[model samples]
Target: MTTILKPLALAATMTLAFAAPALAQDAQPQAPSQAPAEDKTPVTPEAWAVHLQVTDILQHYPAFHSAFQGPNSFRPQATTGNTVDATLYAGVKPWAGGEIWGNLEMYQGYAPNNTLGAAGYVNGDGAKVGRSHPYARIARLFIRQTFDLGGEADDQEADLNALGRRRTKDRVVLTAGKLNATDVFDTNKYAHDPRQDFLNWSLITAGSFDYAADAWGYTYGAAAEWYRGDWAWRAGVFDLSIVPNNAVLTSDFSQFQVIGEAERRFTLGGRPGAVRLAGFVTRGGMGRYDDATALALATGKPADAALVRHYRSRPGAYLNVEQEVADGVGLFGRLGWADGTYEAYEYTDIDRTAQAGVSVSGERWGRKGDTVAAAVVVNDLSSAGERYLNAGGLGILIGDGRLPHPGAERILETYYSLGFAKGMTFSLDNQLIQNPAYNRDRGPVDVVSLRLHLER
Candidate 1:
């Protein structure tokens, strides 16, 4: 506990240091003559905007029972990890009905076991790659255009990548360039956004919907959406990594993925709800589990999927639903499945997954800016995938050197977020994982986390 608290204390100090200026500015008293008169004229839409955000997460887990350990197994010892990131979001109206945006970000830190071992990994902010020192990158640079199709107009508020303006509810929107696939697909308002909501990978995204992305979860892609009365349709294509889970992406677009989705919006008992069905197919150089295991046996060695690579296609689909049960309470869930015969391409090693959760605001408790949420996820491996692991095969995030007893991975997570200041929040999260890495012989670990976030 002391080890965990030290870093959190340091992070809290840093946050206060960064926010002191803004807090002081708000406290300054203004002269009577400096107060400007209120304008009665209508406001004009913003031509350009800029936003900034910073997030820090510290996580810790205690040692658990482990009959045996392997190279890819989560260590059976108490440990702690921390990750921090700062981002700048800039956007401009380049033309009527068109906008351009870019995100510059710097990140540092690591996840437990450097993001290995569990299929439903604990931290959504934890990337596959990590460094002791902060590294900068152009996280996103994209263009968006909308064509109004005649419908009631709605006011859009100024946001990270949005300009304060009005747009028709019925429209066709097109976007292209570098961004995270989740920005345009498989999104759920209650469970998405690790910076503000749930921090589990499986809960943030469909565990089996292996979207195209590099190590940092960003890629080049193009997507189009058509929204009408109560329905929307979406389609997109994205470039895949040069190799499965590699940091480099395929620049030539030889290996890629295509995705499609349909969503329905409806009012149920005076409450709003949405359902989405999404599917994806990837064409890339991948390996089959059985083939990899076969080759390993022929060579009298441990299974290695990379030794049996071939050009093939993998397909997957998922269902997502979200409903507002009350003024400040919402429910969300997802079910997903993928082609388990082939090795996973980009996401974690989940072949089948089911998740459900609830989120509630603190309005009822007289703390409108606070929030509390809880979720559970069950992740499984197909027969072929299980056999491959039994043969000593390694996967994107899980492998126990050998699998004598395989069980479905189960995760239960809960969190409470307190908004103490404008645009600033602090959260406490807890996760209980059973049968980690699908190894019944291994553990039921407990993890705790602290998060601080600031946005402007």
Candidate 2:
């Protein structure tokens, strides 16, 4: 714990030093009204808008019980990891009903074990690839066009990737270009967005949805959305990686994925809530778990899914729900399932998953800018998957040398966030993971993290 504490202290000092100027500039902040008077001003779109955000997370885990270790196993030793990212979001209204937005980001650092050893990895902000020094990339560059369908007008607030504008309640939105599939699908208000809410990979989105993306979680795609009378529908087509879990995206549209979702919104006891059902299918070169295992046994070699890959489709679906049960209190849950026969094309190695959580604001405690949340998730693999893993086959993130005893991976996470200043927050998070990587013999790991986020 001493080694972990030292880096934590240094990180805290560095973050405070970086945030002092912003905190001093906005010393006094006002509480935001729950509902501002509807802006009745004639519908007008902003010409341009700019927003920026920076986030740093430091995570540590103490030594835990482990019967044995493997190449992809979580280290059973005390360790610490950190990640930092800064992003600038700029948008412009190019035409009356169209907007173009771009996100320029710089990122550094890596998660524990280079982000492996668990299906529900600890840090959502951690990327598959990492570097010791900072690097820059255009995370997102997209254009959106809206078509009004005759309904009451609504004022849209200016935020990341969104330009302040007025639009009809019933409208059609079309977006195209490079972005994350989760940005449009499997969204939940209470548990998404690791910078502000739950930080576990399973909590960020449906674990088995396996949306298309490169190693960085972004890909070229197009999406269309329709909203009308408490009902919404969304669909999209996106380019997949050239090969399973590869960092390069397909440039010729040879491999891709298609996704569709339907949502229903309603008022429960006068509180807003919504339910969504989404499904996806990816057409790509992949291998079946059974085939890989059989080939490995026949050849007396370690199982490798990549050795017998062929073009096929992998399908999956999930149900997502979020409800504001009470003032400043929210509940969210997700259930997901995927074709366990084939190797995971993208995302973590989860065949089925269930997640649930709750969040409460500090308004009840007389601190409106504070929040606390807790969540739990369970992940499982199919019989075929189990056999392949036990036979020494490796998936994208998880693959021990062998699996003698298999068990579902279960995780519990909780966090408390303090909004010490406007647009700035500090959070303390902890997670308890049992049967990591579905290996009952490995361990139960405990992880603690500190997070600092600032935005404008």
Q: Against the true structure, whose TM-score is highest?
A: 2
Which TM-score value belongs to model 2? 0.91
Q: Candidate 2: which stretches are off by over 4 Å?
A: 1-44
Model 2, residue 111: distance off in Å is: 0.5
> What tens-digit string does per-residue lDDT give for candidate 2 at 96-152?
889999999898999988888899999998888888999989999999998988788
**Sequence-dependent TM-score of model 1:** 0.90
Q: For residues 241-345, what per-residue lDDT tens digits would candidate 1 score against the true structure?
A: 998989999989999999999999998856899999999999999999999889888988888889888899999999999997666777899999999999999
For residue 17, give model 2's deviation from the true position in Å. Answer: 34
- Candidate 1 global lDDT: 0.88
Positional deviation of 143 in candidate 1, in angstroms? 0.5
Off by over 4 Å in 1: 1-44
TM-score of each: 0.90, 0.91
Instruction: Find the 10 residues in a row with the least total lDDT in model 2.
Output: 14-23
